[model samples]
Target: MEKYGVEVQEKKQVKEEGLQELPGTHENIVLRFAPNPSGPLHIGHSRAAVPNAEYVKRHNGKLILRIEDTDPKRVYEDAYEMIPEDLKWLGINPDEIVYQSDRFDIYYDHARQLIEKGAAYMCTCDGAAFKELKDNCKACPCRDNSVEKNLELWDKFDTMDAGEAVLRVKTDINHKNPAIRDWVAMRLVDETHPRLGNKYRIYPMMNFSVSVDDHLMGMTHVLRGKDHLANSEKQKYLYDHMGWDLPEFIHYGRLKMEDIALSTSKALEGIENGTYSGWDDPRLGTLRAVARRGIDPRTIYNLITEIGVKMADSAISWKKIYGLNRNLLEPIANRYFFVEDPQLIEVKNYEGGKVIVERPLHADHMDRGNRLLPFDGSAYLAKSDIADGVFRLMDAVNVDIKGDEITYNSTSFEDARDLKARIIQWVPAEDNVNVTIVMDDASLKTGLGEAALSDLNVGDIVQFERVGFARLDEIKDNELVFYYAHK
Candidate 1:
């Protein structure tokens, strides 16, 4: 059996299996994947996006891609386009695309409704002062203002500068969670929104905007991080105030990927400081980075689905993703030869002159055709594989190496097997392309790849025989650049 065959089989079984039933009414099931457009969608974002999309597909429901870009400071202008492009690459097609910046009026109207119902109030108190009062289980002085007064105060929001005022939802002041006690619903942001510009001074807070949108947009299930569990309690007040039916809130566990940075702000900082490349830098966990490395979107989908919406936290290593990705790439990615840090070896006592080696692109799938390589008596083998030994030169010849001497032996696999020979890959010294592989650590490995690699276009994933799998990233100036995916 092939490596990861059982794991891949298990994944196939998971694909055939359905997720546990959602708790709410099945009729008109709608889900929304609301990601703040701080940066391109990363693997963390996929954890939320994939499940919603898969559930929608299973139930024949609607999935909304909501760009929660209300925070002018955090919004990345490029993310407005990058987010959708990343999602499209992930095969998650939202039924509707909406931006929170476009729905300020709607959020404002909902705020007005809460104010009219005396369930929300505009607090002109300083942030620190309001926090002091709320911490003591006491309402801020502004909290007691009349509904009419609050409405008048809300009307004066345009006149308010940033940080001067915020609309607070009426929650239990004595609630155990101080963070939830009278949470701010909306605040004044004087900064120009990336999408909206200076059109409005007031902006809805994440919880407020998310709650309002989920309710108004008819979101049937709200898939969110477990960290939002308290926010879930906070949003319930708005639902109660507006007499709106609450969406089924599903709080999934925290998915902390080991060693993979998911911070958009930090990634942007790295890019700006020249500490890293762009969003798709090999080290980044962004979907673009993963895609550039030839990681199939289905790998993410399958992995996330297998994790499902469990509340138990999952801390996964890159190996987990690589294992799953390897399963998906094994049967598809073609094979080639890449000799890293090449050591030249003379094929002495070779009766054959110039030989053309035609190896199958994919051993199991012969229909994929062959990769042809013409070998003379000289070949480039990796320096690490040049130790004294009896070795098989892949589809070429068997060789006996002792010290500086390397002499050709019989080519029969049976003969090589009889001696328990090591198998090593090699590229013909003269008939190879200069290749550079960008490793996962953002390090570069320069080598000589089989001339056949030049035929592969950008974005093609290929296994470098004894080397690992890599995706062709660029072909320029007679050199092939690849991003190493995994072993």
Candidate 2:
């Protein structure tokens, strides 16, 4: 009754109720998101996570969060801690958490079992000699070694230096895909792991480790990039040798985002050289960056769901993602007047110079209430929003400009909404709040916002009328600093 190496989960029969029955979700599917902790969780990683979580929910299945942190050289302490936080931010909570490093002994046990079964053998062949042999489709001489001797060398991995010996799973040396031929099952790594810190020497490569873990953890289905199609075939060989059921492998296309760095190494280097502010830099495609830009988690979830489990590569356009996000935010984000690169406009020849303009928080959603924008004859408008003849200060008032003379039109709100007037965002020049927008490329756009914006709490996402969607990051010195999500 063991479940994922621990508590037993009661399996429920899956009920099909959807558009298309996926390849591997016919039963009590146990899916997982195995992320190597060498970097933060990027959007590419979420492509695996959010959809799998939906499968577990829809199919009454269990989901495992397996941290594949066996590669010591590239592992980072920050990455190890940051990954789960990012997943939680994406609304993913695993039913079980498995750390590969914590189960070194378990992987060792399976490796030894494969050796005893003659499915794997230890190779002491010199690197150059073995490469030539493998290149020529010839088995290493060590492949024919006796079981007792193979086990002996396997145990002596501790006494041997890093490259002196390795354990190779026995496969057809003439395998069609050369990369899958005689893959390394276990090898001595001389480096210390960030977590384990020299606790073990011999380590299993990704293929053997993932194959073994998936089987041992009772994984019923696997959704991954087609780049691992070869690896999946190699693992199938191992599964066949071990007399195990092959998990349903639903391959998917690559999710490529243009002009966004997803490589952990490249991002780290950028951060090191001050090219990026941090992992949450707006330029990155990491979940932290996406979240910082105020894109909703549901935006990512829905996007991946649309991608589904297809076996083709997809280069998702930034415009598509932003467009999707804008759709979600427009309905909920409260509207504000943000004047960018302000141009001063004075209303003259008026009966009373001051007017308190009342605008709805959302034009379509008057139920949410309104904001009080007071203009004492002086207001600021966007330099681009200014035209020579006529315009309306959105929800505020209508003014007619003729030869440096601005004449205040009727102050009736209904007339302004009906005149077919060119409506533009405006703020009182004297009492406006300082608004600083952090754009996607990390540049700052400083402007004036209606003083009503001062009431917004941090983390409140709003749309500046005619500007774009932005998330308030912080409030300081009577100014609101926001991260621009999208227009």
Best by TM-score: 1
lDDT of each: 0.89, 0.85
lDDT by residue for model 2 over 142-246, one digit each (tens)? 999988999998888889988998898888889877888888889889798988998888888999899999999999999888989998988988998788999
Q: Which ranges of candidate 1 are over 4 A from the true structure? A: 1-18
Residue-level lDDT of model 1, residues 234-317, one tens digit each, is: 999878888889889999999898887558988999999998889999899899999999899998888888888889998867
Per-prediction TM-score to the true structure, in the order listed: 0.93, 0.92
Question: Following a full C-alpha superposition, what root-mean-square deviation does model 1 have from the true structure?
Answer: 6.0
Clashing pairs in 2: 253-312
